[model samples]
Target: MHAALNAAQRTLVREIATLGTESGVGLYIVGGFVRDLLLGGAVREVDLVVEGDAIGFTQTVFSRLGGRVTPHRRFGTAKWRLPRELATACGWTVLDFVMARSESYARPAALPVVKRAAIRDDLLRRDFTINTLAICLDAERAGVTLDFCGGAADLQQRLINVLHPRSFEDDPTRMLRAVRFAERLGCELAPATLQLIEPARAHVAALSGDRLRHELQLVFEEKHSANVLTRLNGFSLLAAIHPALANTADAWLADKLIAAEAAGAAAEVCWLLWLYRLPAAESRLVAQRLRLPVRLTAALQQAQQLGAQRNLGRKLASSEIVSVLAGVQDWALAALVIAAQDEQVRTNLQRYRNDLRYIKPLVTGHVLRARGLAAGPQYAKVLARLRDAWLDGEIHDAAGELALLDRLLLQR
Candidate 1:
């Protein structure tokens, strides 16, 4: 397990272990970092648990490591901040620290009240059994496995199980996470855990918009996000989040999501693409419910309007395509090209993205003014005519553009 770390990570871990031993406190690598290590995947983040005042320990790290320490006293946590350049030179993680703590929720879906506790208590409080496993970082006990929750066994069995029956109830967002982990790991939800999802469906609506939206964003981030959404839809979980999402037509969704993935669309674009087929009003309702940024909500509505246009399927000149799509959100255009079936629509969208939108008349407003043409409605008319000529392949260069300009100015 120690061999999995790169040279810089090894150096930092050794230093942290030395500090923890001298201080007489236990420190362990915990959660996703350990889980990914067991899975033989490249670990992306490193989280550390200290059986001591994590804030103070983080200050110690800052004093010794020459980085900023941002401590959160209320949460018993601190971030060892490092400059990007320094972090890459030293390690992937600057060593984020959290107290090994237990949590109790007064009500379902409420944030947990926490108390500092041993590593065993902390492991039990996590979302999934797979994530409950940890590895000791203390030098004498380095690489020791701590699995009070049978997390390692579950990991071996390729199953996802909650630590307790009330797991999803206490935090509804875990339902989404459960799906995410199960799908990502190619594991199945334990039968006991699968049955609990139905009841949790009722509580999903109570979650804050930010929480639910953030979970959905993670879903889109997955490589096989289409499959995840399919599972969510089958469970009616998507509908529980929003009625408009209730029936996105699985086949259509799969196709567009695949195309979106192929296009390397951002999560925000993926989001709008998911809602691309919804009625404008329902799409707006979902956006409002999720509290999506106003720009995205507006893009969702505009994508529907633009996608609904019947004329897009017909062959059109480049300038005409621009006219139809002018001022449309780039996100909307991106979503449309993925959702569009007509070859002409896709071709025109590509043309506009790559060429038409950026094509300016060689004869500019300045040139028009220099020619003694007043800057008014006629200036716009002549420029539009000149540009259309350029779009239609009537003009190829500045010389052709000048001739077109003369004809346009004469007509004006």
Candidate 2:
């Protein structure tokens, strides 16, 4: 079939083809780029496969495109990332590249032994039919779509069918990918493909956490993330990954997140959906397992505390809300705001989010230290005392808080 390419895409493909020919190697635009083209979707990421040195050829092509090529000599792989602005200019509006020749998995769902191979061999090595398609980028075959596994037909049918029965076992993460493709393209998984995933779910542990996390994050970025999560739960893969994630006693938060998504909320809603169920302990476990960023970890902890207090109806008084807002930077209060059960809490959340509520502590450690309060735990205690009084409405203004601090210091 003749795959259409815009002028910019054609220009980029031409450049890659020229580079391949000049270097005496064959190159093919393969994988998701081909699949997305057949589906008429926007292609932003591109993967190119060469029948020669991937790293060497990538360096040549990147040089032509004036991109920074990072070569992984150990693995014989290379990456060329177009600048955000040039990404679209360079056929990225066409697809992103995952270039390699061929790969052979040692064990089912284990790392592959990669080596150079013909374009056909490379395409045949892919997990699914839709992903096995390739577009010839060379001048001789430009616009020619190659489908060794009937990927074009499957694309037409909007089906996610494995290239082989053992496809899932070769990489169980493909099960999630199948689900993502089904949701992203409004396709259905072939019956055999759906059946194959369950038995292969055990193989997921063999896959790297980074790979699994990437797939999970992609699924969550989808509009049907909640539905996808439900599907994963139904397939029993969710529990297999993290047993704690199963049987969520309170799925209200999940439901709320789904509702928010249905109303066109952004990706942050997905993070909040899991926060209610992920208490401090579980959050820490997950963070450790996922190697979460420190900022995200702290945010999760704060959200957990806020969720617990909100659940307990600890009615975030004006002061409590202000204090919480002061310490949080990122999505710190996302769960509290998203899962807030009370109108007052929601209103306060809005005020805090809009920067309408700012608290300038009326008393400081310096003042307390000067007032016969020695440094150390006492400084912390005095500050905490004043902050509490301010939050609890015991101190209404700076003068009132200072007066209370003075009296409290004198008593001390």
Q: Where's the lowest-lDDT run of ten residues in candidate 1?
A: 85-94
- In angstroms, the error of model 2 at 407 is 15
TM-score of 1: 0.89
How high is the lDDT of residue 246 in model 1?
91
- RMSD score of candidate 2 (Å): 4.7
TM-score of each: 0.89, 0.79
Lowest-lDDT window of 10 residues in candidate 2?
90-99
Misplaced by over 4 Å in model 2 are 1-6, 83-99, 248-254, 259-269, 310-318, 357-412
lDDT of each: 0.86, 0.71
Q: Name the best candidate (by lDDT).
A: 1
List, residue by residue over 249-337, the lDDT tens digit for candidate 1: 38888888888888899877889878887777787788888889889888888888887788888889888988888788899889888
